[model samples]
Target: MNIGFSAKTKAFYDLDEKAVYIQNASWSEDVKSISEVLWLNHCGQPPKGKIRGADEHGMPCWIDAPEPTEQERIAEAVNIRNAMLMTADTEIRQLKIIEEICALTSEETQRLMSWKKYLADVYRIEPGNVSSIRWPDVPV
Candidate 1:
């Protein structure tokens, strides 16, 4: 038996039996108390919700389900981007008001100022697409 590790999971393979065992890090830590077995074989197909990837023995490993559809993915990205923009705008406004009474570091005051550009770069959208809720000073 050979053992291998990944960021979130660990794997054990028995080449002679053509089988592999995998467990998440949290589950593996308390494996002695678990009654269920996590086993997979080289020749068997990936079960219902899983997809396949290379295992420790260079054989197949059943992995979690794939990502959502393109439309769902785009919608999720837009939602997250909107939330981030809102939060950034709020912070920028608060920082601007606080700066009027006392000196503030440019880092703190400008942290969210370029958020639109960043989101544009990350999402491959034009910067103009990230319209602010009410932050007229922070142009797209």
Candidate 2:
């Protein structure tokens, strides 16, 4: 979430009146943008009081939380991307169900199976063509 749109960020800045209003937000899809904004926000917040942390070398620790490493962040992004795809897939499945609903029949189950086959033939996974989805993967 962009700092502008972050609920947590608003709370963070609200704690200090002197904190500058930074940015409005970031797209959920843009991992780098989110990470950069987060890093700048945390590391740049001038360390509060000179209090030693539990770590032996600690003069001050900005967070009990460690910075999210680049790979860890990318992994999170990967999960987000995967979930988005699954969400899209779920919507497509629902649309297929709706189409089947419109053709309500005594043989509702059979008609649904038939419509699913038709959908497989038409829906392209990569979106070059809606009518290009292969038949084998479509539900029966």
Candidate 3:
């Protein structure tokens, strides 16, 4: 499929089928079919965490996405860890209730211990280094 870009709409499209292929775009009268070779030369879509922009010649190009600051990374890490914790909340509470009411079977005891360790591991995870953080496995 041939790729095209509409400067008027600032959108990319599949020219052969006359349909927008990237970004929220509609068929525009100013759509110009970009050379497939040129598009390929520009490496098509930008890599993850990057954005599509224009080169010095105004041709489509890739640009680096802004890096998050340390504080932002820490916040993101906390958000992810909180989400993981939420998933275990109900199970942990149920196990605690069971333990309070009666003696737990060996299997239940093991499961509770595993979940507790998982929670501890998650809690001990430091922020601002989320990329290298190893997430604890979820209980089966």
How many Å off is the CA of 62 in candidate 3?
2.6
Compute each candidate's TM-score over C-alphas. Answer: 0.34, 0.30, 0.51
In terms of TM-score, which candidate is stronger, 2 or 3? Answer: 3
Candidate 1 residue-wise lDDT, 53-108, digit = tens = 54544433577877767666557657765666666566667767777888778775
The root-mean-square deviation over C-alpha atoms between each candidate and the true structure, in angstroms, is 12.2, 16.2, 6.4
- Which has the better TM-score: candidate 1, or candidate 2? 1
**Reference-based lDDT, each prediction:** 0.48, 0.41, 0.75
Please identify which of the two predictions, 1 or 2, would achieve the higher lDDT against the true structure.
1
Error of 2 at 71 (Å): 0.8
Candidate 2 local lDDT, residue 61:
31
Off by over 4 Å in 3: 1-46, 94-104, 126-137
Candidate 3 local lDDT, 1-140, one digit each (tens): 67776655546767766543324445777666788886776655668887766655556766787788878888988998998787677678899999999989999999988888888888888876777899889987
Backbone clash pairs for candidate 1 read none
Best by TM-score: 3
